[model samples]
Structure formats: structure tokens, C-alpha cells
Target: MPDYGFERIGKRLFAEHLVGGNFGNMSVRDGDAGFFIKKTGAYLDAPGEPVFVPFEGPVPKDASSEYRVHLAVYRTTPYRAIVHAHPPYAVAASLVTDEIRPLDSEGEMFCPTIPVTTGAPGTQGLANAVAEEMRHNKLVIARGHGTFAAGATLDEAFLLTSLAEHACKVIALKKMFLQ
Candidate 1:
């Protein structure tokens, strides 16, 4: 991750509540280093404190467990930034629905559809599953886990993630009214 870009992304995500209390991780590729990620347990509050690890070589054993998901998305998409967040509305939708079809214009623009990835946690198999699901969309819900969003920059990724969360909330509200 470029130092400045990293800082910008961290602040944006933190401000959006996509990342806080060390709950999520974000990364961007830096030259031949592969990607730079936040150090484990690092809160987004201090955007300048993350460590950039080289991805061209072996991943550090202590790397974030979600590293595989981030790497897979980066490799499969044109996205330069990837964000994984445990957003409330998205999480609630994921638990109750296997598929979140586009119910509004924002969903169509940011995510035409949101598929659910299935697999055990912290495994490459899970990453592959997510990559496959993401082939047709910019956002996805990891079943009972969380949400992932990707874009040309971290800000775009964060925007898409926020859009997905808002979409979910709208869908939830609609369902309530229908009942």
C-alpha cells in the first residue's frame, strides 16, 4: 500500500464505521511486495500505524487470517483495494438469506447481486469460494461471517461496502413493512 493511500483508506474506513476497535482489515499492493496490511489487532483509529508486508514471498505466519480472501479478490479483480467489514445490516441479511438480490438502484450500481460464500474460516478453500462468488459483483457476504468489498481504490471499496450495508438495511425495512 502506498503510505498516503493507506492513511487515507484507514481514515475513511474508520470514519464510516467499517473498521473500528480492530474489527476489520484493509490492504493495498505495494510494488513487488505483494500487499501491505494492518498489523494484527491494530485499530483503524491510528491510520499511520499499519505494517506493510511483502506478498511476493511467503505470507508471514502471523498474517491476518483473512489474508487469503484479500489476496484472492485482488488477483481476480481489477480492484487495488480490498476491505472486509462486519457491518450490521449486511451481517443480518447474510444470516437470514443465502442470496441478496438487487432490490434498489444502489444495489444495482454498487452490487448487482450479493452472493454468500460458504466454507470454514481462515482457509484457502473459503477464499476460492469467495472469489468465485465475487466474479459477478463488487460486494459479497461471507455467510455468517462478514462482508467484503473491492474497488480501484480503498475509498471506492469503502464506498461500495457502505452502499451494500445501506442496501441491506433498506431491504430489511421493506421486509418489515410487508409483514
Candidate 2:
């Protein structure tokens, strides 16, 4: 039932190009046991079915490659949902700064400052870096990759992804033609 939210979020992500191909993953806490994650290689726009993964033992073989990243955040934070996406503008911003300072009003209020991390995707180093940043920031950009965002719900997490990208777009635009 809760996984339905991911379906909607996924579709939106695809439509807005927040994620393309099989480049993103999402999950929602399903109690203390574990959480429900999108299947590996599943398209966010229309992920066919959900996979319920537990916290105790080994991760399912079919789970997304970034499952470790999602688990790490849930283990250390109160956030119940996570969204990982390769937003073009955000990734571009990461190449230029350690922190993304929001230019838009909504972005300034919601995202404020987004930290950037560097590491190979699905590595503990990357996961730990993201979890560490989540201590004070809900959204963090993984340099040369994308964003790792967490929130009370999938929609909230998704909003951070969108906001980060939008803010980065503004920054990029200003630096380009506006300058």
C-alpha cells in the first residue's frame, strides 16, 4: 500500500528527467524490520513491483545496488524515506562547489545548503558520507553522480531532489548567460 507512493514519485521523476533509464532508486521504511525498496534496474517512472528488504540479515540479491546507501541512512537517521537521483543540474553544480546555496525562495527555505560527497556509488564511504551530512541537511549531492535525499515520506524526499536540481539550474543559468 505504501509502496504506491513510490510508483507516483517514480513516474514524476522520469517525466521531469530527475531520473532516467535505471539510474535512480527509492525506499520507504516498513516498520523496524526493514523497508520496501525498488527493484534493481527498475525504472523509476514505472517500477513494476516493489521489493521488501529486511534490516537484520543480508540484502536481497535483486535489491537495488544502492541499497546499502538507503539502509545506512535509515539506520542512523529518523527519515523514513529516501530518494536517489542523478539530476543533471545538481550533478553539474557538484562539479563546481562543495555546497549548493539555493537562489530561489522555496529552495532557500527547503534545501538551504546541500552538501556534496565524493565516492564510488554503492560504497560504504559514499553511504557514510551521505549519512553524516544528513545529520543537519536533508539533501546532499554525490559529486559526479547525483543526490541522496531523505525525508519523513517519499514526497518530501522527492521534493528535496527537485529543489536541489531547480536551485542548481538557477545557479547555472546565472553563471552562464546572466553573468
Best by TM-score: 2
Global lDDT scores for all candidate models: 0.74, 0.89
Off by over 4 Å in 2: none
lDDT of 1 by residue, 23-133 (tens): 777877655446766666766557455555565567776566788887787677666777878787787788888888768897877577788777766789889988887
Error of 2 at 23 (Å): 0.8
Using alpha carbons, what is the TM-score of model 2? 0.96
Clashes (candidate 2): 0
RMSD values for the candidates in order, in angstroms, are: 2.2, 1.2
lDDT tens digits, residue span 67-115, model 2: 8888888899999999999999999889988999988999888778889
**Model 1 Cα displacement at 116 (Å)?**
1.2
List the candidates' TM-scores in order: 0.86, 0.96
Which 10-residue span in candidate 1 carries the lowest summed lDDT?
1-10
When summed lDDT is taken over every stretch of 10 residues in candidate 2, the lowest stretch is 1-10
Candidate 2 achieves a global lDDT of: 0.89
